[model samples]
Target chain A: MEWFGANSFNFEFVSSVLQINNIQKSYGSVRALNGVSLQVPEGSVYGILGPNGSGKTTLLGILMSVLRAQHGSFDWFDGRYGDGYRKKIGCLLETPNFYQYLSGEENLRITVSISERGDEADIERVLKLVGLYERRKHRFATYSLGMKQRLAIGAALLGNPGVLVLDEPTNGLDPVGIAEIRDLIRSLRQAGHTIVIASHLLDEVEKVCTHVAILKKGNVLTDGPVTDVLMDEDVVELDATDREGLRSFLLTQSLTLETDKETGWIRLRFPKGQAKLEELNRTCMQQGIALTHLSLRRKKLETRFFELTND
Target chain B: MKIAPLLYTEWLKVRRYWAFWGIFALVLIAYPGISYLFYTGYQDIRSSNNKMDAMLKLMVGSPFGFPEVWHTLAYIASFLVFIPGVLVIMLITNEYQYRTQRQNILDGWKRDEFLWAKFWVVAALSILLTIVYALVVLVTGFVNPDMALAGIEVKSYYIGLFALITFNQLTIAFLFGFLLKRALLALGFFLFYFLIPENILIQLSRWRWHTGNWYHYLPMEASDRLIPPPPYLGEITNPADYKQMLQAIPEHILISVAYTGLFWLFCFWWLRRRDLT
Candidate 1:
């Protein structure tokens, strides 16, 4: 409560901006989401991470009210508002969905008009924010993939929405485009907006997300803060002069928790900051094993993602 | 949200739509062009003979006046009804093609508001066409020797009725567009329904069911009845012939209203039931 009260910068005092309970969706025989549930706290950058064909996009579609879920429900802002609650939440679902013949400025005008916020002042502001202000007059069909995605983000930013829901905002972009979008997302979060992103990019999730949920085959395997869920552990790769002897020796040591041996190196997993190279060397010396190659590696979200969703 | 802003959004989408503008220009040209053709053909007939029947000449010359304006403008308008029909189909289908309909729902528009925005567009279209029709009538009045401003009495009511008739035709297109979600397919079926299927049904009703005259009360036929052929029996404009033609106005109006209401109900039900995806 103290952290939520003091650190929370947004005006809303509510802890959970979104509460999704047991959301289930299916496309005919293929189940898109199976009993998925998660909560997004206020002022948190929430990332829904999964592989392709997982329930990430389906869940985002349902939250945007574009697709109907067969089961379960979700409430936004604690049900403080009715259907109009969508006005406070902006969304860019799936791809950049805009009228191709319309100019970027015109498309934003249309979005602002639909929002009924009664002004186009934010249109220019958002265009500038997305770095599309100079090309605001260009037709959407003429834009590159990066520009199209940026225009979509600008449209989503209209009316200064409190919650921004972006589904694969950086998909199909080059390295530079991806980096720009990542920076933009981080900047938006820094400005105190709750951002919910659904992505297959684990590196992006690690870089921008404060909290994350890993999904596979329509089921959420785990969800929590980034530190607890993904970056909580470290991996160690150590090899001895006698490889077979070191494998047997690692299985007997208390410091070595989970051990896997490849042809070249024996990999050991331990809690972050707990394992020391000198301590492992002492153990190797006592076991009559001479250490040849020893290297410490930090586990990335990619490694944890593979671990959780492998099943 | 106020409807004004929604309408503005709708306008923003269509104002720059080239196809919509192209169709609008086509309708504007086609209606007046058809009217002028009739006028020139009438003039040629009169010039070929010293006396080409006084009443026939009067009917042709006063094409903008009451009774004749209703027939001429309404028939001309129906010939171009497909223009607006295609426009509505494209407008509705473009949303589906681009998947902006999903974006719309996400942006806080109720599904009903989205539907209403299209209806508002229809309303604006009807008024614009009606004004053009009125302008054509005015030009016809200024040129024709038999038609003066005073002779065009009861013209405003028929113009309103013509606008309603056009809206009724557009509603058919709207229902098909919403249900089909593809412009080409909806337009194909729309043209097929109006150009061939309705005629087949009317003919089949007469031959197979022996439902003579009653087939005229069918939805499309009833709207067609609103604009019957001009009351000119070859070279005669007998009062009894005119009365017989104008007698079904009330019936056609009632049937059109009922059909429009039915189409609206179906549209509402379908929009509410179908997922945006």
Candidate 2:
């Protein structure tokens, strides 16, 4: 349950912030979502990861109640809030939707008024938080794509809602803007707000999300803590004059989970913290196969994602 | 939410929008401006020295005077309802254009709440139109030198009839904007329907098909009939025909109210059922 390592804060009791059940939707013969379900834990940054047309937006739309589900239901905060649950949840679905003629400050005012959560003072704080305080009076249509995206984040941050559901929060942002949003999300997590983000960027998800659900073709291929879903395994590569002998010898070892033969090396997979480079070198030499190359590397999430998606 | 906040939110949106203010300004000017022109033209005919002009004035009487001014202004102002009707369409379609309708629901508003807020706006605009009509009637009646205010109580209900006509027209515009979801398409189709199609259908029903009183019940036509053209013009040409037109004002009011309610209900149903995407 405690997926984060030593640096992570411990939650004495984890609760579900959002529980989605078998939500299905379609558009004129295209099945956008096929019974997709997932739960977002309280105080955790959850990522819904998928490629374009993989139903990430569709699922978020349904959960936000902007788009109706064909058959299924989702509960927020255990339905304790009734019809007022949305006020507790701030969401930015797909593109940054705002009145083009209204300034950023003016737009967030409407948002604040509708949510009935925050006030004019909170609006100032959020505008500054998203670094749009200076341009707050500028019309949304005049802002750059990055600025528009940031203003949207600023709007979502209003009222200081307990949960923030963002679709591609880092979209249209430059490298620095992306990093700033990541740090902001981390800071928000530290403040005990649960965040649900839908993104196709593996790097973004891997860096910021504690938990992720990988979706493909309207189906969830894998979902869990990032550490578990990515399969934390150490890969050891070995090359020897007698490749066949090294391969046979490594296949016999108990630490080797799987071995893959490459052009000039044999790749050995082992569970995390189980790869012993010195022992493998010594054993290979004793087996009369002198190793030419010996190295170890951890498997990347990108690799794991590709393996799961088979794309 | 409550009605005050709902209307306030709508005000926040349009307070800075020049298009909204521009259309509203046009309404304020044109509503009374056109009525004033008709009043002056009738005054000119009344003061003419020619025998025929004097005789014609006798037949028509003073349309700008007390009781007649209400009906006269209502008929003239109804022609300009399209000004505010365009405003309603633009406001509704702006949501679809910007996709803020979905964002409103996403932020916290129930789908019905968002729509009800707009319905209140329509109601407010209708009331404003009625007030303008009343002011025009009062100013025109009081300014006419030969007119007496004694008959002011007669046909005072035309003010409410004016409001119903505007409400029905605006609700129909709301339907167009909601269904089309695009400003140009909705406005174009609305104008085409209001200007040409509905008129043609009404004429065809009356002249070609000889459907008695059926044409009066058409959506916009029902409201149009609530305030028939200056009864004097009908009196001068055909007294019996014009007299027959006034008999159906009650029925026209009922049909107009029903159409307004039905249009609003249809919009509510569509908004609740269709995906805001």
Candidate 3:
């Protein structure tokens, strides 16, 4: 819970900082990102939501200076490629490529050596934070994919950087691993580091991000506060043996059904202050059909994410 | 900004990387064995003819029959062949091959800064290797019981040391590595075309030569200044002995340093302008 820089709004105070403006990028004829502009606020968790091939990684790569942009520019807060600036930005633009021959500790040590802010204790602290302290001495080549990913995170954490920018940080994780990473990211944010995570997992982003940006193709679909950007309407999902019967009943009862894709259930979006669940259940029972399930679905970041990035 | 720790880390990288250690072991232990085997083969040929030039050729490995210590030293360096060139290539290319360059470049190291450190390390290794070769020659003279080996001297060792370290050789090597973005290929190209005529001229000028067939001042001929020469060269002349000649042209040290300096400037400019990707 320690913030490094307390600079102004015009000045970035996020231990991590990225400022991009109308950035455009293309690979051959494929436009990867187009006219995307965003400023990640200081000391908050920011998330990018998009579908596959939605330019999330492309944006992160540009911020890391790993890839160049055809148009627009960026500054890694105050210091744009400043001296020793990388030491302040702990970024996992993608899965890290650690030395396969080296142990987690050894790999961390090597990165720490290269970092301007390197301290020996940081190696152990980051290991502990990511819940891989016990496996610190294990060779990276022998680690499980999740453990390798954790080790990669530990590498970025070396030298105790101010901000953490992770692209798909919870990629390929089981529920437990996902929860653990979520907790770890939350803890990092509490420690006063600004974090920007780009992920296709909208639920994960919704649970953690204070701000959100949605991207589609090579364009910024929309970006803003998580609540404001995603808040469409509260919804309720209805599941039963005869979804057509339930859908007809709900439509007659004044509820709106969105898409027609049936993934083994029927879902309806009811406006706020409109669900009389007990009465609906009574009616369904009277209709001689067993109600398999009913659950109130919050206006999810995922729906907005899909809506913004669908095209 | 903080160079000490970075240098230590790079040192550890080379120390721990298997290729570096493997090569280091070969250089230290195999050189003497290889040299002895070479001489043994030469002595067999010499026995058949009873010719002194055969023995000298065995010692110096040359067709230009000169007897100076400097020419002999050049012969000794050539035995290592592309090792020095390859070592410089490995310095950056290994990092690229391993995908460690991005991390290193992002770890507060500018491209030029990283190259500069590698430059220093390569220079130091070159100096060390040259000195060791020179010392081996000195030791041979002091310890050899044969009267024929008593004339070996060790001055050109230091001269070759300067040439090897100077950016003259490494700049081109590193330049090619940076441009190709592959170490082995660049080093291979350098080694394959190393002795070719026009290629040396182009490298000598950094493709900047206006003079025609500018191969005269190349390392191939100038490198001849390093050791005892083949028998056909008229006479062996020590730098100290040729006081008048020494006074006439620019000093060997100054020219070597100037060439290195100019090459580095070109390297820096080109590196800055090119897209490193």
The numbered model that scores best in TM-score is 2
Write down the worst ten-residue block by lDDT for model 3 chain A.
A2-11
Residue-level lDDT tens digits of model 2 in A45-140: 998988788899989988888889999899988888787778888888899999999999999989988988678988887787778899999999
Question: Which stretches in model 3 have alpha-carbon errors above 4 Å?
Answer: A1-16, A80-83, A131-138, A233-298, B1-3, B30-71, B144-162, B165-167, B195-213, B217-277
Q: For model 3, how does the per-residue alpha-carbon lDDT over B1-277 read when each residue is reduced to its tens digit?
A: 4556656777767655677667766776554555555545645665577577456655444321112333443455544645656767777676667566666665556667766766677666666666666555554434333424333432444455434533356555666676666877888777765657645565666556666533434543333233223322323544443443334234444544666666677766765544333
Docking class of 1: medium
Q: Could you give candidate 3's per-residue lDDT for residues A233-264 as a string of tens digits?
A: 54666678887787787678676676436556
**Pairwise DockQ winner, candidates 1 and 3:** 1
- lDDT of candidate model 3 versus the reference: 0.65
lDDT of each: 0.80, 0.85, 0.65
TM-score of each: 0.86, 0.90, 0.74
lDDT of 1 by residue, A97-200 (tens): 89999999998888877775425677877787778889989899999988888888778777667788999989767887788788877777877889999988
TM-score of chain A of each: 0.80, 0.81, 0.75
lDDT score for residue A50 of model 3: 80
**Candidate 2 residues B27-87, lDDT tens each?**
9999889988887777676667688667865776767888888888888889888889899
